[model samples]
Target: MNATAKLDEYIPVVGQAIIDDLKLLAERLAQKHVLHVNSTAVGGGVAEILSRMVPLLGEMGINTKWEVIKGGDQFYQVTKKFHNVLHGRPDEVTPADFEIFMETSRKNIAEMNTDYDIVFIHDPQPIALIQKKGQNKWIWRCHIDVSKPHPIVWAFLKEFIVRYDASVFSAPSFSQQLPIRQALISPSIDPLSEKNRELSPEDVDRVLAKYQISRDKPIITQISRFDRLKDPVGVIEAFLMVRKYIDCQLILAGGTATDDPEGLQVLAEVKEKAADNPDIHILLLPQNDFEVNALQRGSDVIMQKSLKEGFGLTVSEALWKVKPVVAGNVGGIPLQIKHKYSGMLCNSVEGAAFALKQILNSPAFAKRLGENGREHIRNNFLLTRHLRDYMLLFLSLDYAEDLVYL
Candidate 1:
């Protein structure tokens, strides 16, 4: 199928009215050259969103291209530190960290082709690419929760951030009091993508057998990178609490991103916390979206127990499958979940355990939450909504009066 026709596959999920509106907006942005730059082509939400978004935008008659900036091990190490510090994590970042980041940024700036109608940069790893701006509209998309960023780190990043024509944040709370115009656009998942696609009963069972996970007990799975911010260890702690009363197994499945240096360290921490419990399966999953889809589809309940989040795409992924979700009450997660209506939101490990138990104990309540959550995701968190928002953001530069919020 052609790009727009391929996008029409979503028409059944999102109504024709939405698709028509997108086409109308796409007409305004017809063949408009847009370049998206980030640190890596694999792993992370930014990459996943762009993988579907860029292609669909091309189908919509927008000349969209994605670029990954080149960097060495040391450069990613510094950026990962910047990522941690931006999310209010305690990291001992030094001046040398700043130098390493720029050293790589300078190299990328010299090599990358930045000429386009709109230059969209995702996160801090590429915020410095603003140095190559020349007459085109530049936009920086921050996909992380930066509500409590360290001053030194924020200041260093702010120098480049302010240079952009506009900035996009996943949540309103994540928006800093910045000089540039800001737009609130949450990240999203493709309902048609493998990670969120519907899996057959046999397919689910096959994946479970592959992982040696049994269907005899309730499965509580959290699909995320082994990042401390995701709090996989805390998920294990909550799962342990639930297993004390209920016969359930925990699956902490995810792999490290090329850009993230601490994934192995965090995985080690989760394994140690798991403590060789056969009930807990710690599978370091590769980029197998089908396996993820099977796990979520086969599970009785899904959890995204994040301590800090930019917009938990996993929460939306589970909710789209009509699975009950228990997520943290921080960042963009609250935007996806309405607490007890769409899905349960928890504040602590104890709270997560309590919510998980509530879902397990009451089938009616879990079903209602799952049903409400699917509709919520349908209306707000799907890829079509994300496309509409992005097309609106891009057209705003020309039709300035059309977008007053930005």
Candidate 2:
């Protein structure tokens, strides 16, 4: 909606050298059309990144557009089951589910446009669009952790995935043994975006009070979609464990995604689990970036206890704010946090609780970790770095046979 944010704006945060390099890379792919197609345009991380990334790509002289695939309730429900299976969950995906997906994909394929220099199909929902691919280059971007996916679901999706010219994964571990080439491009947070940008003390206090959250005690917050993989119930258990040692409040704040049919069920389960505890607050927030920013800024500590995660962008988001985070040591979280240095990584509820109590009791340790975490994000996980990687990746597609240097 706003004018494409100039790369010069990021020079102060990521330095001038990074911006110069991006300009050089963007020049190589000038006027190339790039189309990013995904399932939703509003809720999830893929949409969030493209919302900002597409406009910037246009500013870089690359013709870019983003589109969302159309699907019905039955289609989305089947895809939600597919999502759970991809995350190594035991979901009995029936033949009827597969049929529903193919039927929906067929409809999307017939209605959507495929004319672009480079077409990026994100996740499994729209992977079948490659069937309509012409001479245009198509890249499949997998945002979920598929290292150990359900054999049936993985086998089913592999048929569509292998057809892409290349695939992109958030982390090396999240990459599967696909026949196509794989690129490890981690997701990033836009420092200039409303979700991660600086906020005044008054704004933070206003957000907290608006939510009716008391600041009498230290607050522990986790901002994620209410998905099963995020382990919202596990976060509650960890909070209860920490409550014995420290008097802190827990805030499980997140909204739903259009394609994720299980979100309401997961939120209900979390509410049932947290029913008796008055200190545990479960706020079903809308996808408001400023509110999320204020919540992370106002919290004394942040937690992301995902049973399985793709990259855990929330971990990086909180770290960007210089908040000491206690996150699960699975998926791409370890890459963001070097245990006990930038932040603490836990494997179980007990471990998470221990880390929370340690950080809450020792303000000095928390401050040091928070500072280190912020510097780490500034160097590696900013939106500027993500843009550079993507621009280079797009340029690399042209030199597929040659050993290209980026």
Candidate 3:
């Protein structure tokens, strides 16, 4: 089937009722011009979701388009620092950083057109684009954990944030006390997409063999960008702690994004820490969805040890595959996992090691957690639900009553 036509196949997975509901919502949004503006067209979850969402919106007959903002290395570096600070990390955002960001924003403002019914800005990189807002509804979608942002950085971004008609956050904890109306909209995964789709036994084995990862021992994997916030070093430390008790291999696989300048530096640090540990396999993967799917399928345990995150889409992705995940107890991860019920949550390397051993030791218990996790994703974190929430948000903006004071 053609790419857009293949969306119909999701009906069987998400149920025909969901497809019907989405179609009904699309009717309300028929021909409405909605534009999505973000920093990059690839890498990270925002781009991944948009890559699938924009097309499906078109398939549903909405006049939708996606655009990427332009910036240089310095701009990305400043934004990376902004991202870190926004996640409550200590980072220096000097006046020079502000100048670089504003200069690039000016260029984008000059070169870009924004005449649409609704303009959706994703994340911090293209947030300043709201300056070009005219007679249109603009919504800022924050895909980060901003509950405890750096005071200076949050104060600076709040200037542009309050201008939007509304803002959307992935989880309630990620929300801020904003002036504009806000909606709690969780991000989602496409089960039919190559990244989360089912793979044949041969396909999974082939991917494992391609990476020279043996199935002889249980395989533990963590897939994410090699960023420090992901705490790759902590994952290695946790794996070392678990390794002292169990016999398994570690695969830290990920790719770099255009807007993340610190990827290579963080990757080098991880390699240095790994230090010729043959059992620890650090693979720098391309943005290949099928390969990612195969890697998740081939693994015995999955880990997402992020220090801070938006929703940690990797957690949901692994959950969708019915893989028992041991993730950091931060950000939106709690929304996905229900502690020892669906999956395990860890606060430190010791906690992670403890959870790892618990799952790795009991196959039956791990399988049950995996089953519960898959159902959780099926019920809450799929693409259909996200599309419905976004469509409803757009429709709500056109309502006659802005406020009702009782």
Winning model by lDDT? 3
Alpha carbon deviation, residue 385, candidate 2 (Å): 1.5
lDDT per residue as tens, model 1, 1-406: 1223378898988999999999998998886999999988976678877888988899889999999999999998898888878878788989999999999999999999998999999999998999999999999999888999989999999999999999999998988999988999988878777677667899999999999999999999999889887899899999989999999999989988766679888988899999999999988788888898999999989999888887778899899999999999988999999999999999999999999999999999999999999999999998899999999889776654643632
Clash count list over all predictions: 0, 0, 0
* Residues 58-81 of candidate 3: C-alpha lDDT, one tens digit per residue: 889999999999999999999999
The C-alpha TM-scores of every prediction are: 0.88, 0.88, 0.88
- Model 1 ranges off by over 4 Å: 1-5, 256-278, 399-406
Q: Cα RMSD to native, each candidate? A: 3.2, 3.0, 3.4
> How far off is model 3, as Cα RMSD?
3.4
Model 2, residue 78: distance off in Å is: 3.2
